[model samples]
Target: MKKSIFGILTFILFSMNTFAQNTVAEEIKTLSKDKWQWMADKDVDKLGKLFDDQSMFVHMGGSWGKERELEIIKTGFIHYKKADIHEVFTPIIIENTVILLNRITLFAVVANTEVSNPFMVTEVYVKVGNEWKMGSLSFSKLMGPN
Candidate 1:
């Protein structure tokens, strides 16, 4: 009876661990898609919610603050009439409380000077308490026809 009880407890613990990993993976996917949607709609406030207070963005041009990124959307320096994100791949790496999300986002800009640029992106997330906060996000442009 004790052996059976131990086996059940072990099974439960393993199941919980698997569930946690799956949940984090799903959250990463959702956040990634939401980011593209926010960019397309130029939603600065929504975008701000996804970033950490100390979030740093390194664009193809250079680096910028999370606030600065929001400002660009607010000021209309970057505008997207419609941006379709395709061929997205997200890989999650978890080490205790730290999670790393690697993504490849292929997108076509419906409007803007920078159009048809496909990107392979990487983002890092840190689990702070019960919340998963994005610590760092970066991207590289892929050379191809878009």
Candidate 2:
């Protein structure tokens, strides 16, 4: 019957859309994990490509632009030692923008001393010509034990 066919088509379309969203979420999640590793390793070149030219980064100490962020990583001003990711939630805000929320225990070396802290990191990625570039990174310090 016509109704039965229409129902099937609708279900198929909905399923496909859900699948695509999941795919994008997974891709962004992987990229986020890779970004943590790259930061730990001080891979500025890779980070530069992943970060948009006008990207903004907000840290507990201060906020800065993409170039300054990269420079800090390169100069060991705030070396990322490790990121113990507790959870990652990726939500597609629009067709071209995805917001990734990461709960993590971040270890870093600052002033030649090691420190660990819990943080909720918000990362916004925007699609640009078939590539996703990080547009913003904001770290919110979490209270209590790390």
Candidate 3:
């Protein structure tokens, strides 16, 4: 009788944990998509809020801090035309940190020309005071055809 009660309690706890993790994963996934849309729209204000103060962005061209990244978006230095997301992988959540990986074909305008490239984008988010702020964004260029 005692063993049966303990087993039920353990199952309940495990189910709750799984549900919480799934919820976090879905929330982060939505945030990731919103980020791409904000970039394409050049919504600097929203992006600024979503990005952590000390966030780092790594591009094929170079890497920079939050300010420079926001500036680039605001000024259309490299216009993010589209993010054709192929897949959003399950996030790896550890306490206050979450790492989300996405496979996408990104379209951008650079030097007055439009270019599309396949990339694996890594988005790192950290929870702060009930909000999740992007801490890092790194893009890895994929070889071969998109």
Candidate 4:
């Protein structure tokens, strides 16, 4: 009787943990999707709250921190006109941090010239207090068509 009860309790605990993990993963996925839209809209106020103070952004041209990135977006220097997302892979969670990879075709204007390019965008989110803040955003251009 004791062994049976213990086994059942262990199974229940494991199931609950798994469900919680899945829930968090889905939340992060939704947050990432919203982030893309925010970038397109140039909504710095919203983006600022989502991004960590020391967050880093990496691009083909250069790498910069949160404030500079927000400034660039606000100024329309590199307008994120649109993002054609191909896939958003399941995120890997390490304690309080989640790492997600997104395959997308980005449409944007740089130097007043419009361009479209396939890219694998890596996004890292860190849980802060009760909220999740973006810790890093990096773009890796993919070869050929998606």
TM-score of each prediction: 0.76, 0.95, 0.97, 0.97
Q: Pick the lDDT winner.
A: 4
| CA lDDT for candidate 2 | 0.94
In model 2, state the lDDT of residue 29. Answer: 93
lDDT of 3 at 20: 96
Clash pairs for candidate 1: none
Give the clash count for model 4.
0
Each candidate: how many clashes? 0, 0, 0, 0
> Over the stretch 83-135, how does candidate 2's per-residue lDDT look in tens digits?
99998875756889999999999999987889998999999999999999999
- The C-alpha lDDT values of all candidates are 0.67, 0.94, 0.95, 0.96
lDDT of 1 by residue, 1-146 (tens): 99999999999999998887777677777876777678778887888877788888766767887888788777666664443555545455556344433434434332256554556566776666766666776767878654
| CA deviation > 4 Å runs, candidate 3 | none
Candidate 1 residue 91 Cα shift, in angstroms, is 3.7
Candidate 3 whole-model C-alpha lDDT, 0 to 1: 0.95
C-alpha RMSD by candidate, in order: 3.3, 1.1, 0.9, 0.8
Clash list (residue pairs), candidate 3 = none
Instruction: Quote the lDDT for 129 in model 1.
Output: 70
Model 2, which residues run further than 4 Å from truth?
A: none
Error of 4 at 122 (Å): 0.6
The better candidate by TM-score, 2 or 3, is 3
